[model samples]
Target: MDESDGEALAAREWRLIREERWPGPMNMALDEIAAETAAAGGPRTLRVYRWEPSTLSLGYRQDPDTVDWGYCAAEGITVTRRQTGGGGIYHDSHGDISYTIAAPADELPGDLVESYRRLCTPILDAFDRLDVPAAFAETGRPALHDPACYLRELHPAHDVVVPGDDGPRKVSGNAQHRRTDAVVQHGSLTYAVRPERHLAAFADPSVDAATFRERVTGIEDHADVTRTAAVSTVEEALAEWADAAEGSWTEDELARARERANEKYGSDAWTRRRPGDR
Candidate 1:
């Protein structure tokens, strides 16, 4: 190996992956690839991606039967599952910025809560740069995990929100999946929220449209933010805060992701698989 090759290999490097085209299955597969690889002594990766035709992404352990398949089918909305645990989310193509940040477990705090907050700084900083008045929620989480991530108000320390007369309105929904080798945290930032649209697919009679509106507020609704602007702001600030060097996926990474998609994420056995199903 060349002398420069040794230097490159020795230095701890951060990688940024921006996904321009990926269906629900491929996206989830890629996130898992990053997590598993990092845990196995690969480079850390931060990913920003978008979904096409929108998608309803279920939490890892969430019962797939919770959603109305007939409604989703008729509406042409696809359903997928995440490697992380949180409430399901509607990734609207028009109004959401999705991101995943993963690193080896040793690089982050052992305390899960502390690590979650640390990863959120980039997003919170992006909000500040956009001049969006933001703060972490000061309230506590629900006693039980809400099926829909947007429905369950996130922990005040981890969720970024804007002030409201009623309370802090959540702008971002985050969740974590801790692996033996890596800690992956990913989330959605809504530029616009059509709660009625999302609720129609995921919420049952237990949740009403009014309640959904009250709990979640879109960035656009709260400010003049657009999807492009939000994404750009995040790309710049998040990369800087995390000290990442923009990069692309390696061939091996893509191959592993595609293999994972075929074996798990795209399969019925996995998408609908409940926790401990194995």
Candidate 2:
């Protein structure tokens, strides 16, 4: 077969894991496992998932002080740190739709921006499918609040925004963690805005719900789609883009992910550590 035919066949063999709901640590652990599996010659995987009981995912280097521990505990929000760097995100069970794409590093472009564009194409397509008119932010905007992901400064590569009467408002945030042999890009697509809960996740976030409403947006804000429809749209978009077949986790993979969650993602030592300490 020709090189083009070979590439097309490879794309069609990609794996799609339908949305599953899990706690924060397990969700993060599964992402790591997916990357490792892909690097070991497993199928390239695209997984959609939700966090049950909600969660607050802190950036790799985000300050612990920025989080409102008391508030999170009171509200039953699980706090965990992600391998990717960015600000903290409040992953509301009803408000956020999250996804992860994992593949061998060599399969993606070496250039960071190019790789982001390649991986984020399906996300943009998903927004289009929902009639949300979302696209990568054209320029970086000065942060309205530093510790919150949605309120942080926007980057043209991974931050997706939708047009508003006032200006563009952010709708999604994507970030990557590249290992020697694999890459995992995960993003949160806001399905519905929960500005109060988002801001409350941070300690003394100098901004209010009104300011958040002005700067951030969700799929439901611009489109008439319901949360279920939004989730399905994103899944269909990713599957079609990768030409993927539905798949599920193997028993061994799930076991390893559980162990990793307990030892790393679920541990306070890992979550509270400084940036380079790990």
Q: Quick one: best lDDT, which candidate?
A: 2
List the global CA lDDT of all models: 0.78, 0.91
Please report, as a residue range, the 10-residue window in candidate 1 with the lowest summed lDDT: 1-10
Query: For model 1, how does the per-residue alpha-carbon lDDT over 1-278 read when each residue is reduced to its tens digit?
Result: 23553344336667887656587888888888888777877778888898887888988888887787788879877789887777788888777788888888887778877877778878888888878788778875452237777767567656777888887677887878888778888888888878777887774737666777777787787567667878888888767765678898889989988988888887889878776796
Clashing pairs for model 2 are none
TM-score of each: 0.89, 0.96
TM-score of 1: 0.89
Residue-level lDDT tens digits of model 2 in 25-128: 99999999999999999888999999997999999998888989999999999999999999999999999999999998987889999989888988998998
Model 2 score (lDDT): 0.91
Candidate 1 at residue 71, lDDT? 83
